[model samples]
Target: MSQIPLLDLKAQFETMREEIYEAIRQVVESQYFVLGPVVRKFEESLEQYVGASHAVGCASGTDALILALAALDIGPGDEVVTTPFSFFSTASCAYKVGARPRFVDIDPGSFNMDPEKLAEAIGPRTRAILPVHLFGQCAAMQPILQTAAAHDIPVVEDAAQALGSTYEAPDGGGSGHAGTLGRLGCYSFFPSKNLGGFGDGGAVVTDDEQLAERLRSLRVHGGVQMYHHEDVGWNSRLDALQAAVLAVKLPRLDLWGQGRAENAKRYDALFAESGLVEAGAVRLPRRTGTGRHIFNQYTLRAKDRDRLRAHLNEAGVGHSVYYPVALHQQECFQELGYGEGSFPEAERACAEVLSLPVYPELTPAMLEQVVETIGRFY
Candidate 1:
């Protein structure tokens, strides 16, 4: 059997060798590393792609979320509702600003924040609803928006895992993409994401001009001028080198995302017929009702996920558990007073969910091997 490792980024780099080299060389030729013309151009192009009036480049995804919440003045004694099933950074960002992260169980199928649960979690101290578009699909947005609007709280989208994901509005006219539906949308360009860069990079996108302006100022350490600081803000800025790499990669995101979606479809079909579905040993990834599923990780819920993971790895198929520990169960958030049974679904998912190799570059033969290996285990 071939030693098929997960996420062969070197394969992608090899395919785009000349273009990447040229982009890097161009950035090197121009000595402006911090917030240079390339960075500005990337920001403008990203804003245009998302239909946002502004895009403020930041240092990382966590910082992007923190800055967005901080810009909204949600701090100390305030609460932000979010799910516990995402990357630790989602809740960590809220905590960074001294705001408590209120947990809500995720929708089992979508793996996103359940709107009904979100509505139940809101209270007088709830400042915003930080809905994460987890694992490449957008969360249920219209209902979340309605709930937030009723309480006059903003929606800060954690779009780190979803750049191409879209939604259909109720009226049928404003059917648009993710990262633009909320008051402020935060995106990550970490090397593993669909829209990735050479290194850590992130952005805050917004249609509101004032919010956009505040984000811009915040990215630059709260300074509109050289010697003046309008407010306290972190030193978060997207460097030019990562921007240049992302500028080269952005055009290919849609194509790569489509490839991932196709691979996911193949996995769904293979798994269904493999007797796993009938035997109730495993379940498949969710294809969102309105938009696409990019198969960021091709996660499946399996019985004894850790043991199953060991079986697959022994068969030379690489895999991962996106998050084996839920936030409330982690030691960091014990102060929130959430004990063992606080969020059962999230805890269950943590122990049962397993991520298989699902990059766009994966061939059908490789996918077949993955499914076949899992079948052998079951």
Candidate 2:
């Protein structure tokens, strides 16, 4: 159906169609589609799920990052150290609030930021470390956190791709959720994420009550009451409609997460059976014991990356390159003084990594087609 999409939201929607309609119907009938009970309920559920003291809803994930940092007075004259391998929003959000993004290279093995280089990158101006849990895998957080602690800098987690994923659970190497390991965890409800909603929305979860209160105040013009400004905050509150939609989807997240885990295992087994490992033809994803890899995208690194993508497409097997360019090399950020080979690992990943269809709704037959297509390419 639909050419075996990289991800088929329609299949997911069908499973929850009736419940989604009812959730929205209730919100619509009440005519309270703005920040209301539904949003707060979802926030409360999310906070409990992650073992955080507070969760504050916002308009979108990018704003979630912006608000988390903004509330902490992270702006001009500050540097937020992060990885160059992730989505631009990880760095762009820092820039939005006037902070400079100091990028470090990634661990070629884990596809996560290297902790060794992180300590070296911190300078006197470093205010925070924004580590992204790329592709549902958490960064090596303990070391990153320790480094920040030594310098008394806060950490904001870009757990945008990692909602139900944990770093220490069965999937990850450790015991804490990826985002919870930081001072503040920012999540996105972008349409393509594991716990996606119908539209854009996000939230910030923190163990600090003061930070939580500040986030709530910040999302709505800094007003404790309407028209009464205190802190000059932006208007970024979450809508009740999106909240209801997310709530309806949240209950099924764990089950879907399990599907992804199983899918990853299946891929591993298939690749092993096909002798690709012995041939050194495919660099499969690394699943270090620290976090649950949610398999947001079943990415593989190989020599003939573009050729493989074309062959998969010819076989009607969907695939994509998450980011063909590293954030530091992007045209807009050229003034950051980065050029070719500036962050070689990240640059190499951009050229080599290819994302394949790994959504929960994908069938075993579809997976076979995907593996077969890749085998033919090899």
Candidate 3:
């Protein structure tokens, strides 16, 4: 038996190697490295794919968040309410723009911000409601949007891991793609993402034409023209090469997402049959809303998580913890005054969550091997 890696980018690349080579060659021949026709074409394609009126490409996912915040004029003395269990960039982006991040605990089932606790966290300084679509599952956006509307604050979605995922409104309204559901939706083209490019890339999508125009300017040092400056912004323009690669992959993103979902189903059934759930030894990821879960990483809560991780490592199985520490507990956030036990749910998640291989290219035999390894460990 060979090692079952957590993700297999090589397998994905082999399927479209020539297509990718051709795209890269086109960029090299044109010699247009910065934002130009190639980047614009990709951006337009992304806008149509994500169902957003506008999509602005940037340098990285973290920069996407910062640009969005800057476009909203959220600066010092303002606060952005967000979940504490997500990637560092989700909270750190607020700090980058000189705004404070107000932490909210996550729903243990979905690993997303609990909308029930959102109201209590919003203060007069609250400028934006930033919710992360963690592990490709949409946050409870209906309530989050309603709360934001009540306060006249904008909702910026961190859809870094959920490019094609959708969320159906609970009120029987309709479904919208993850990034397009909020006022400004941020996406990542990091190599590991579902719609990943060859290198770092990101974009911000919005229906607000004004914000979209501002985002375009913000990515190029706050100047739409060659030298005229309007506002202070970062140099965060997305590379033409990355955009070209991403454009090649965008059309197949939903198909890849489907494959990931199928893999997740297999894991769910295998874990259930192994009696781990019944014995309370492990808890599988849960699907909450009527939307699709792309399963960026199939994470589960396990008893004695560290030992289980070690066992998998010894067995030559790949596994990882999305986050090992809650944001509030990080040393850099000490002045925020969040002590231990402040967010019990997020802290518990940080301690027990472990992600397994759920990439699209995994074979059923490989999935079985992963489950067998876990079953033996238990």
Candidate 4:
């Protein structure tokens, strides 16, 4: 085997080039670069797809978080509870809005904030609870929602990595998409994401009418009426050009997600057939609840991860670490008073998780090569 890249956006673009180019051409002809009809149409499409009452596009996923925090009026002297295992923006968004970020541990299986730990972390000053949908699986939202509702605290979901992931309602009501399970859900359209656009873009989805209105206003300098500022905000509007591209790709998202899921299942079968799981050499990703897991990155916990990564590279297999360090342990967050053992599970995860090539574009031959390469590594 020569090599298998971690992700191949080129392959995806090849199939949708005509549609993408035409959408961009339409945007150029319309002469609208910022939020306009194109953006509004995309937002409506996203709202219906995600089953949310409202979807507000923005500049980036990080901005989406800051907007959600600002829209909810969570600021100084307030605290937001979130996991230490996720990307920086997951916790930094709270800090950006002048709120303290209270850290919690993660579930070993799901790599998401442990709902059990969240209950003990909430305090009188806890203004919001943010849970990240890590990798491509929805976090345990049911318990998290119940905990937040018990205290009347809002939950902002960092669904940046879980665009099409689903979570079934524990009450047997029905299936709920990743972001819609909370007060607000944030998504990223970064070039590397599963539903990535041509460039940076993001959005905040919500079922609350008032919150959605606030978010829409907040994304554009907090002005609902021209030049009239209601609340202090930032310049985070999503570009119309990017929206056009996203709109063209939106219809194919479910199909692409299914491809990723199929790839994940293949990995499971291959690894199991090799007896890697039982040998204690590798731990496969697990589905924590009854939900449609859209495998954004099929990551596994390998023994001697550092050695395995080096060996994979030597074998011409492309791989990457989702996170090499936990948030609490980051030097920038030292002021938060978290030390080495603040979040043991998160720390351990940072050292062991390795994401393999699982992009929808990967062929069966590529998948076989990746598995065989890793199997030989042991």
Candidate 5:
């Protein structure tokens, strides 16, 4: 069998080649490169798709977080509470804005911030509550939101990996997309994301008109009008080309997510039949929430993860470790005074979690090969 890739953007591009080319042609003919009509139209479409009142396009997902924090005026001496299991930008964005990132441990099942631990992380200096929808599932937003609202603090969602994913309140209050559930939601269109664009691109979504306007100004160097600065901000505008490409792919996002979900189910069935779980060789990803899991990645908690990774490498099975280090344990964050046992669950996850190939383009044969390789490893 041919080698499987963790993600195959080339295969995805081939399926929509002409449509993508036409989108790019329109941008090229217009010669409008930066934020323009193309970007505005994409933002409008995204707002409707994500159920947000407004969406502001930005240069990257990291910028989306930084802009959201800056707009909220979360500067030095303020604290931003977030999960330590997420990508670096979740906490780094807070640091970039001159605020300290106070971490809350994750729920081992969902791999998201533990809502029960959220309130304790919030103190007098706390400015915002940032919860990440890690690996395409929404964080338990109901309790998180209730806690934030009680404190009058805003919730900024690091939804970079969870564009089409949703969350249903356990109380049956219905469901909402990952980004829209927060005061501000950030999405990444990096090539690996489910709804990725050609290059770096991201957006901030919100229901607040005032916050939306602030985000718009923040993306364009603190002014809607050229050269008119209301407040200092970054030049983080999303490119027109990337916006056009993303618009073309936006309509089919749900179908792609469905494909990924189907692949994940197959992997689950394969692993279950392999006796891996019964033998305690590995633990399958648990779907804790009642909402759609887009399966941006189908990760497992494997015993002897590093050795298994090397075996997969030798067998030519595509795999990866989502994060080998918790944010608090990173070299740069040493000054934060987080010790080895600060977040035991996150630290344990960093050691055991291994992501397998679950991209939309994978074939059944590829999936079987991945599982077979793991079975052989044990």
Candidate 6:
């Protein structure tokens, strides 16, 4: 009769309530809500943490994407190559800027954009390549970066689920943080994200100082000075309160990620001992082991996924599909002429992928119960 939620935000907040409240109180006392000193401090701290030269705070993760696209001057006939197996905003950002989102199939093992298939997708109109760090694991960035560099296309790392994740540099120099690996990296501070704020907030990180300045200007309606328009941009400022809350939580992020990683390892061991892998009933997530992978969500490929989901629900376990439909097959993108089997890997993932409760706050007993319930179902 034990009930487990998919993400226990309350449990996490309880541990840091006093510190979080104090940060909020300081912001409230300043009475400067939008794009103020607190937000600037958070941006500087975030830039340093991500190993980027600049970080521009924005309204939300979705707004971060739009701002990135806009700042890059991607519009009209430009095309962006990206995976079909992600949240709608991944592709929708391209659409928002009046550009085309060229979809590519994902690697079934990683559930990320296939790097080998990327070359064929790039064309004359392709302006950028967006490789999402889906499920908190960095994608195959080496090959993807090579392909993008060869074609002279900018790469945007959609690190929404991968704030603290790291990947081995393509050139073998050393380890690089997820958001610092590409031309522009976007992050989310949604209430459910690993580094969740009190509400909606996001940021774009980049090494290019000029692009960073442009992103900053774009977020504040494209103005270098107040009311002086350099370009047509939208209002997308990250609030000071959210920034303060996030800054308070920022120092503890790596420890939290380590907890999630330990839990993931425990689940792997538990599943292996339970014979689920041998029985071919459930497939665990594959880790490249090249760099740090913050387990934002521990997803599995379940045979008879729908039935398994039902059983988990009946057993008081919380679960849900990360994406039930590939972005290419969405109704809004039907004009692109993609059918059911356009991206087979992504489509199959949509049908079978189930994200379990992998939050950092989960206890060993909770994880075992989750695994036992699934084992019994299969």
**Best candidate, lDDT-wise?**
3
**Candidate 2 positional error at 330, Å:** 0.8
TM-score of each: 0.98, 0.96, 0.99, 0.98, 0.99, 0.99
lDDT of 1 at 335: 94
Model 2: lDDT equals 0.87
Residue-level lDDT of model 4, residues 200-260, one tens digit each, is 9999999999999999899888888879998888999999999999998889999999999
Scanning candidate 5 in windows of ten residues, the lowest lDDT window is: 1-10
- Can you list the residue pairs that collide in candidate 6? none
For candidate 1, the per-residue lDDT at 15 reads: 74
- How would you order the candidates by TM-score, starting with the best? 3, 5, 6, 4, 1, 2
lDDT of 1 by residue, 1-378 (tens): 797787889887887889988988998998889897999999999988878888999999989999999889899999999999999989998889999999999888888888888888999899989999888888888888989999899999999998887877655645666889999999999988888888899999998898888888877878867668998877899999999888888888888888888888888888997889889889887766766666667888997778888888788898888898888877999999999888888888888888888888889999989988988888
Cα lDDT tens digits, model 2, 67-133, are 9999898989888999999888999998999988999999998788998899889999999899998
RMSD of each: 1.2, 2.0, 0.7, 1.0, 0.8, 0.9
Candidate achieving higher lDDT, 2 or 6: 6
For residue 63, what is the lDDT in candidate 2?
96
lDDT tens per residue, model 5, 1-378 = 568888888999999999999999999999999999999999999999999999999999999999999989999999999999989999999889899999999999999999999989999999999999999999999999999999999999999999999999999987899999989999999989989988899999999999889999988889889899998888999999999999999999999999999999999999999999899999999997568999998988999999999988888788899899999999989999999999999999999999998988888888998898899999
Between candidates 3 and 4, which one is better according to TM-score?
A: 3
RMSD of 1: 1.2
Question: Model 2 compared with the native: what TM-score?
Answer: 0.96
Q: Candidate 2: where is the Cα deviation over 4 Å?
A: 169-174
Q: How many backbone clashes does candidate 2 have?
A: 13
Which 10 successive residues of model 4 have the least lDDT summed? 169-178
Clashes of each: 0, 13, 0, 0, 0, 0
